[model samples]
Target: MKLKKRIFTILALIAVAIGVGSVCNTPNTAQAKGVPTVFPKNMRGTWYQYYTDGVEKDLSKVKITKTTYILGEYTPKVIHKYIPHDKPDFERADWIFIPGYQKQRGITWLNVKQWNEPAGIGIPDTGDDGEDGGWGENGGEFFNVSKLKGHQVLSIANTIDGTSIHNTSHWYRSVKLAKKLNKRHYKGFLY
Candidate 1:
């Protein structure tokens, strides 16, 4: 009798442990195979550019499709005209788009330029500063880029302050695409 009772107790404990482990290991349904589903489809549109010091520039178009974002030039002039006088002039190059991940913002992007490569580009979401709570610093402001309608402000992150710090360098909004341009413009940046 004693042997049978001991075996029963051990079996019960093992079953309980397996149950708890399975519950803990369950995957989050909100994310698909680890990729988030919150990205907006209509993120394609023209957005105004602004600098960290509150300097605003001409409107630039942003074309976002299923997998990428193609950014247009802020001005028509050559790269040298726009860069600071002290900066070196590189060859005139066409725009290149690459996929990027912002763990802090929780939104992946097809980027024309590397995040923070240009002084005033990148998305900045809203929330407190730090990792102790609430998406830490970048977790809370996961804006639905696809849902951004025309004329609404899109806030950009300020890289100079620090990745842990959330600062606003630019605010942009969706505007009507020019008649000459088509939805194919969202495919990639044209020279």
Candidate 2:
């Protein structure tokens, strides 16, 4: 009787341990604390306009399409070669372009810093101007994704010439052909 009771107790303990382990090992889909995955899936894609020699080729509307990660993050060497005056330690964000109004441009990493701030306001910058206090288009526009329901729109702040030209318009449309790109894979900018 003592031997049987001991065996039964051990089995019960083993079963409880197995059950607890399984529950603990379950995959968690909840957003991790520090991981930045809040960006919507519908917004990841390539937006472009037909341009020839830096000139608009036609008045046709702009188009956006999802593509495999192609564009690479600016390496230290590339950044130094092109934008030497700017700080090398910069994070990349999604590129927001408003055709005709604001040609193809990146949302600068500065927006990330602002967004991280406790009191940061508006959508982060999708364009980089390179150096600080320099005359270039570095400031990004603020976009409220929560307000945008099924409407693809980019609100761009006109950082050029210090003008307050805030242009917000609906994109022609969005096409998703390739896998959806996110910052998790690319680190800074979405491919």
Best by TM-score: 1
lDDT (CA) per prediction: 0.36, 0.32
Residue pair clashes in candidate 1: 40-146
Q: Model 2: per-residue lDDT, tens digit, 118-180? A: 122233345685423212343433322222334443332323333433343222233231112
* lDDT score of residue 123 within candidate 2: 37
lDDT of 1 at 95: 27
Root-mean-square deviation of candidate 2: 13.9
After superposition on all C-alphas, the RMSD of every candidate to the true structure, in Å, is 13.2, 13.9
Residue-level lDDT for 157 in candidate 2: 31
Misplaced by over 4 Å in model 1 are: 30-39, 45-57, 73-151, 161-191
